[model samples]
Target: MVLGAQTTEESGAIAVYHSDDLKSWEFTGVLEFDVTNAQPGLSPDLVPRGYMWECPNLISMLDHSDGRTYDVLVYCPQGLAQQDEHYVSSDQCGYIVGRLEGSTFHVTRGFTELDYGFEFYAPQLLSTGDDAITIGWMGLPAQDDNPTVDAEGWVHALTLPRRTTLHNGVLHQVPLFPLPDKPQTQGFGAVATATCEHDETLSLVDAATPRLSTWHAEGKLLIRRHLPTGDETRSVVCAPGEITAIADGCAVEVFSQSFALSVQIFEEWQNWTTETT
Candidate 1:
């Protein structure tokens, strides 16, 4: 078995290891990137440079659509800045789609965000039957001001398993199964569904110390929160249609057919109700 790991020391690059048995392993070599000088008007997102990479996951899959097999490398790069129109989180999880040849990955397409959500990181890919699915942690690193830590003394949860596919050089995600129709009210979590008319709004409000709200506006889905720390909001572009939101304590993951967005809620609201119109 071969494993990929992030090295904090040395060059802070990704290290590859090989093992004949599950117990013993040997260090192979580091993944190398070719660097080049860019013109003054070029955007930095076209370049890949980071201080350290974390949560390196490498998988080889056969794309039956084109009858070609490719290697996908997913990793979180720490301290990388975002430029241009790329929506990258502070600690972003991205993937490199390429070909693996004898311990080296030849880059076909550059890195891109695996998810545009704020709380998506440390994603793991699993294969079952003939499909590849992914699960990501719905928490941000170095952020520890959530109300759940004080009220329940817990901080994080895994996202619902999502089926992932590569289409037109982008990764698309969808729920593995249909979302539950029953209303859920367990602990600080809730699941709500809404079907929108043309340009309508769907609202979810949680009453108490940390209140949360989500709605679709313009061409984007927006999430706003009122936490003890402060008020904040995050959004992503999506087509107007049916939407579903799954809230867990201070974090909520919103899903649409095209994309997904996850945000943290932190304020207390007096009106504890949800409405869709």
Candidate 2:
């Protein structure tokens, strides 16, 4: 079964298609969800995501907890209202864990956001052996004021490939390859580690323009940026004993034991210096 989304703002849903020979295909039906009635006991207070769903991906995986295989559906939703506090991004990507029966998914777990960041969407998943690897667009939807647009004439990039694993009814992601620990000085990529011995701040700056910074203090992690008009920030609550960050050109991705964040730094390319204090 190949899954895709019908782009509609009002009543958007996922379209299902089937193929037997991998060359010929037939349109099946649509996979629709009613947030009002989904997971009444588990997620009774949850609300609908948005008006449209896009970039739909469906895959099956074995649940190590119960020895049952389940299907995971991942998609990006659009047209989310600003007043909706349930989601962080105006356009968000999430997943649903369920079982598929005849082109239909009977969901077992409620919706969960895939990445808690400012620039994560349109994720594509690939299955290798028993693991699922995903790569996402490191950009947002319907935004055109990026600094890279004026400085570099390009505004988007791809995130580093991440390995996804389902454990204890929750999904965890990490970089597919181990990151370098040695300090880099001349390029757009760098790696840094932080500890909880005291409150710490990690900043990447090109001369005076602030690209991005990560602050870890009081069991909370904050990603801060200094824009031309004001400061833009995104935060997550996690007690990270040690945190790792990887920056590539205009994209920065951070990971800890409890959470992860991926953001696109719009600042022009320069020899960024890493500061710790």
Candidate 3:
């Protein structure tokens, strides 16, 4: 799979190709820019006359559990920013979602499923049939201008891959291995183990679960009663791994392994907030 900028005569464009038998090949045509339609959704006077697309990548996510399939693409657009320059500065860098129809591929999804924070760029994804793995270049045009990055040589690092699942029509993500291995303890010991009264607010110290607000305790993990606010922010806390907040009807379940902990979110309250030792 290939992704790149629609190029023009004055600039270079990135392209991709694949062959099964090495002797025959089939692929998407190159994406080069042209002055006529080079800049999407831009005024003619403000368009960057000549620019090239950088890296392009693609991954396929074909899962039977959810019964939906799609491919992901990542690429960079290299050109002068809003202000044109003789030398290339940079342009938008992010991932795009697409679908494959036999030998024809179409990109229909844009990068809205990204963190709104000021971090992450040049993101990429690799689909393993069950999951579409993602990573990104921490460094970007903004980072290059920052003083901290100038001294560090490396201005950024890829975030841990997250597994995305659509639950009740809303998308949720969990760090592949969301929970930490530490056990919630009591007294002056490790972070997870703590004590709290029945009706009180406590700051979470364990990094194993999401920040939680609850009426009870379970070792180091937190258990919270999810309240409805018609807001996406209303969620359970399951630190290090997945953020577990009770939605219209969802809660977290915990289980134990040798040295690590595993957590699962469920709609059934019966096993939602269990404390298995």
Candidate 4:
């Protein structure tokens, strides 16, 4: 793990460490930041605190545009403050952009890799066979103020697991497989031809008690179908082997393996495997 930050008094520095079992940690001392120092464009979503010179997160993902995998580092510097008010919002947060080459890690550009919804901090990489999963604390800087602290006594929650990949020189995230199940209800017209939108929505209901129950959009991918009792939301986006339904939760967004999506709709959940079209 690598860490970089600034002290409350404005002293700036970066460091590295090594751990075999996570239980025992050996500090590898500070890492050298040789890149441009004008404005380190760190992420503002995750780390809210200003004057940060600590806490570092390293993310490893494939730069498919380049074919090889790259490791990116995010850290803080306590002394470096920008003229913008947004940069000084948190004292507990800061960021950086670094890449890993062989065993050596070096800071490269000065832009925040994470540019999306909500605050995502302390991000780490998880190896899942062929993919790298990125997850981090949704709350940072002052963790105490987070609303989840009241319910779970924990100030933050991990961002939904995102399969990270580079597309057309841009980073893209998609939700993992297996999805949350929604209760069946009424509303859908039929499984006939329906117009599809990149951002689509669908619904169904229970025939016995249409008023008693219904299944709302629990994930990004939805299949237009009949009312009451239908199967799971496993229909591919349009065609099989194209962009199939990856049943996660609302956390799923427009994630494509190449650049297209897989879609399919079925009669019912149990018959998902049996449905041909």
Candidate 5:
């Protein structure tokens, strides 16, 4: 079996390894890649030259739409400069869609943010014979001032299990339903319609009125989060679409056709309300 490891020597690389059995391993080398058309002004999202790339996850998906398979390299790149479409926190997680040609991976599309919320990183892809499933951590690096650690003595969380697919050269992730454990009424769920009534605004909040929700606005998806550290907002430029957000006791994952967001919330999710303005 061939596995990928995180390395940073050659521009955010993934070190490849070979293993005949699960127990023994051999250090092969860095996974070589051909960044085809991935450059400044050529690609919409420039491939971040990360100082460090962590948690390398390599997975493949068959785009049934056109009957073509694509390999996705998911990783967390640190020390990225803030951009209009990138994350404010440099440690954002994202993926590259490409095809593996022999020993070299040919990058078809550049880097794209997997999540646009306040906290998301280190996504793992699981091959289940038929589907590519993903789950990620809902915490950022070096920012652990969450109230849960002081109040509940707990911290960090894994995102909802999601099935991934590739459509039109883009990755789509949908949560697997009937999750074993939901927030147990200690959390909340809401859906933001693709398009609200003309000249209307939809707002989602909990008993504490934390801005832990997403809404469709002006051809974009906007997310707001109220954390112990501070309040922040993130937006994605996409065609108007509906969004579903679910928050259990510890974490919240927002779903949309354009992006998926997983964030940690310590606030009470009871008595949730959606307001129009």
Candidate 6:
């Protein structure tokens, strides 16, 4: 079965196809869903609705906590609102845990953002043996203001390959491959065992510009990055969990059971620091 989305900001729909040879395909049905009714008891909701739904991937993942296999849909929807309280972002990468019945994809748990960073979209899943890994573009559409385009003549990068699984009913991703390295930069990787009871912040900081940081406040994980005029930030309300981070030059990736955040820091030196306050 193949599920494809209409990549437009005015409307959203996914086309279902049936393939027997894995090459030739035939149309089966369209899985058009209402966002308001997609989730039953999930928090930190995705845009009440989305206009542009791109790269709709459906995977069968085993719920590790329950030892049961279930279907998971990874969706990239553009055209969400800018900011609502501590949560921000319009181009969103999220997932829905559900089951497919003949022509219908029913929701077990509605859409939840997969990445909580500045740049991450259209993730594609690669199956390995009985497991799977996902990789996404570490950049966004119409966000081409990075200094590297002028300094090095190129821009953007792909995220580290991540291993995915389900715990309880929630999807979790962890870095599967080492961070990619580039010239003139240092390689940094470590498991940050944070006992963040109240608040904690991990950041790529510089004195001159707005910092790129991921922190936990209350029970939400937030990522803040720079924009043309000022800056923008987003959050996923989650409990603290195991976190692992990697850096090679301006590229940084953070991972945990709760969320994954990736960003490209346009700086000569990538200095990441963690603070609990």
* TM-score for all models, in order of appearance: 0.74, 0.80, 0.44, 0.47, 0.80, 0.78
Candidate 6 per-residue C-alpha lDDT over 69-122 given as tens digits, one digit per residue, 9 for 90 to 100: 777778776676655532255477777777777667667677677777778888
lDDT of each: 0.64, 0.68, 0.38, 0.41, 0.66, 0.66
Give the least accurate 10-residue stretch of model 1, judged by summed lDDT. Answer: 34-43
On a 0 to 1 TM-score scale, where does candidate 3 land against the true structure? 0.44
3 or 6, which is superior by TM-score? Answer: 6
Q: What ranking emerges by lDDT with the best candidate at the front?
A: 2, 5, 6, 1, 4, 3
Clashing residue pairs in candidate 5 are 194-241
Residue 79 displacement (Å), model 2: 2.1
Worst 10 residues of 5 by lDDT: 268-277
Global CA lDDT of candidate 1, please?
0.64
Collision pairs in model 2: none
Q: What's the CA RMSD for each of the models?
A: 5.6, 4.6, 14.8, 12.4, 5.4, 5.8
Model 1 lDDT per residue over 106-179, tens place: 76667767766668888899975334799999887887655566555777678878887765344667776666
Residue-level lDDT of model 3, residues 172-253, one tens digit each, is: 3455544435543432122332343434344332235423343233332333332232211211122323222211111122
For residues 1-277, what per-residue lDDT tens digits would candidate 2 score against the true structure?
5554555556557777778898888888877543432452121223244677788888877666777777778877676654322366778777777777776667677766677778888999898755599899888888756655655576678888888876544567888887666756444377766664336776754535456877767666777867655777776666757777777766788877634678876543332223321
RMSD of 6: 5.8
For model 5, residues 43-158, the per-residue Cα lDDT tens digits are: 14545656677887877877656777778778787777777756577586887778876557788777788887778888888986535888888888787766566555666778
Give candidate 6's error at residue 95 in angstroms.
0.9
Local error of candidate 5 at residue 54 (angstroms): 0.5
